[model samples]
Target: MLDIKFIMENSEIVKAACKNKNEQDNVDKIIDLNRMRKIYTAERDELRRQLNEISAEIGEIAKKGGDISSIKVKAKEISEQVKSVEEELSIVEKELDRLVLTVPNIPDSSVPVGFSEDDNKTIRIIGEPQKFDFVPKNHIQLNEKLHLFELERAAKITGSFFPLFTGKGAKLVRSLVNFMLDIHTADGKYYEIFPPFLVNRDSMLGTAQLPKLEEDMYRVEQEDYFLIPTGEVPMTNLYRGEKLSEDDLPIYYCGYSACFRREAGSYGKDTKGLMRLHQFDKVELVKIVHPDNSYDELEGLLHDAEKILDLLGIHYRVRVLCTGDLTFASAKTYDIEIWAPGTEKWLEVSSVSNLTDFQARRMNTRFRSSKDNKLHYVHTLNGSGVAIPRLIISLLETYQNSDGAIEIPEILQDYFGAEKIE
Candidate 1:
């Protein structure tokens, strides 16, 4: 949440940011509401002071054996006035709180000014898309010959976009999860967390996903719990409503979870193979760090995620998301897109983001600074160490031989208990 004080002091700047984000939140309405709140507060305070004075006067009159009825009448009038102002103030404050939550995070100065993914700037291509001696088959064609996955069975069991893997396909999923988890927990120095897949409404709101993207979530209506869309949602909220000391300036956590999404508006895009799915696996990375080092940590997070692709020897590129492409709570984001040889396209596998206190404010997660002994919101960051299905798609398509066997990357061969899948 953008601080109300900051918005109040700089309404125009806030409005411009809203414009840039193509959001329609009314800055003027918020400002007017705040002004009304201030007026009502002042009126209430003045009336309270008058009520106290009337009490004092009445007490003095009673002690001196003077008529106190007039003072009592005045006290009654003042008390009623104060109650009226309190009621108005409460209404205005509630409205103000509601509007504030609608405001999007202000974009960082470094973010490119643009309106869509097409405008995003490419950072660099890490590895070249391999040239094939024979025609490269897409994941669907390759999977048909290999019999590694069954989409028809999955569809019959759980509707479309649900994946059911068999043989090495199932083992591939397990191996990837373990391999990614090990990288982040071991060399990345991140503590691993196996968080609950279900979360409450407040937990969803804390991650800035509730009010905005309700339709995209799966909710257990009876229990009011939401199946998490990403491990970031639950992992980031671990320190919610808590305060950490300065000694713990930087805290890192990596979580692996089965994510569920409704994908409500997506009708006909990437429906053929593993492009988009209703349920998927992901290894998520989250960091809570001091404001001074958040961007640095963001870079570190990008490199950490990139290492997985490097070890797996997947060809990929990095893209800096333009302002319009940034997620609801991210101040800045970098997406890592891996090349899929069969599809001849780049599939986004991870999005490393620096939320820059936007989420911390919502979660009420703070840290006390030793230098000033003042409490400040810690910067929050999260990324997919990598999402699974697309990576699986890339792996099958990229490493498949002319004979239809998949040569497992050297890093994962031991985990798969074989060098190749035939």
Candidate 2:
């Protein structure tokens, strides 16, 4: 949510952002509604003042043995007018709030002006994509040969886009989770949090996933809960509606959770394998930092996530998302795409974004600045400290041998309890 004062003061910039982001918001309508609400607010305040004056007059007249009925009637009329104005004010405020929610955060000045992913600029490539001696097989073929997962049975049980990992596959997923969490929590930089997989409507809204992307969520209608689309949702909401001290200005959290999404519009894209799944495991990294230092924290967050790919020896590239490709709440974003040899494509495994108080305002999470002791919204950032499925695909495809065995990354050897999967 943006400060209405900021919107009114910089309407043009806000409108330009709406255009760049490809979001439709009636800036004029929002301004008009706010004007109406302000008018009603003044009228209500004036009515209250008149009523107070009338009450004082009525008391004075009664004490002085003068007839107060006329004054009482005047007060009653003022009271009725106040009630009417209050009702009008309520309606206008509600409408203004709805419109305000539609306004997206302004993209950072550094963000490229573009309308699609094609416009995004690649920052750098990490390691080179593996050159396989064999005609490397895709994850689907590798899984089939290794008896890793049962997608067919998963489809029967859950209707598709679900995987039932068998034996070593299950262990690999668990090992990845532990390994990632261990690194993020190392040196106590990130506190590992165990969050609920189900979140309420407010939690979704706080993370800017509701009102726009609600259709892509699985809702438990009876409980009015939405299955989390990412660990970011719960991790960021941990301090919702709370204020922290300056000492806690930069809080880093990493959470491992199962994420669910409907993939509503992606009907025929990446339907096979773990590329598009209804449920997937993700290790998420979230940071809450003082606004002045938030951008710096974002780079640190990105490095933390990139460390995972580098350590895993996966070939990946980082791209700074163009304005139109940026997430709804993110002011700026960097997408990390890992190369999958068999798929011959770069799969985005994580997005590090600097929301920059966009989410903090929505969540009402703030911190008191030591400099002034004034409360200010904290800047929130989140990245996938890499999502599991695609990373697994990249790993298997990149590490697969001609003999149909998969060599495990050295870092994960201890967790996997083996050097390779045959």
268-368, model 1: which lDDT tens digit per residue? 97777889999999999999999999999999999999999999999999999988888778889999999999998899999999999999999999999
- Model 2 over residues 151-256: C-alpha lDDT tens digits? 9999999889988898999999999999999999999999999999999999999999988899999999999999999999999999999999989868899999
Candidate 1 lDDT (Cα, 0 to 1): 0.92
Off by over 4 Å in 2: 53-71
The positional error of residue 397 in candidate 2, measured at the CA in angstroms, is: 0.4
State every prediction's TM-score relative to the real structure: 0.94, 0.96
Q: What is the lDDT of residue 356 in candidate 2?
A: 93
lDDT of 2: 0.92
Residue 123, candidate 2: Cα error in Å is: 0.5
lDDT, candidate 2, residue 334?
Answer: 97
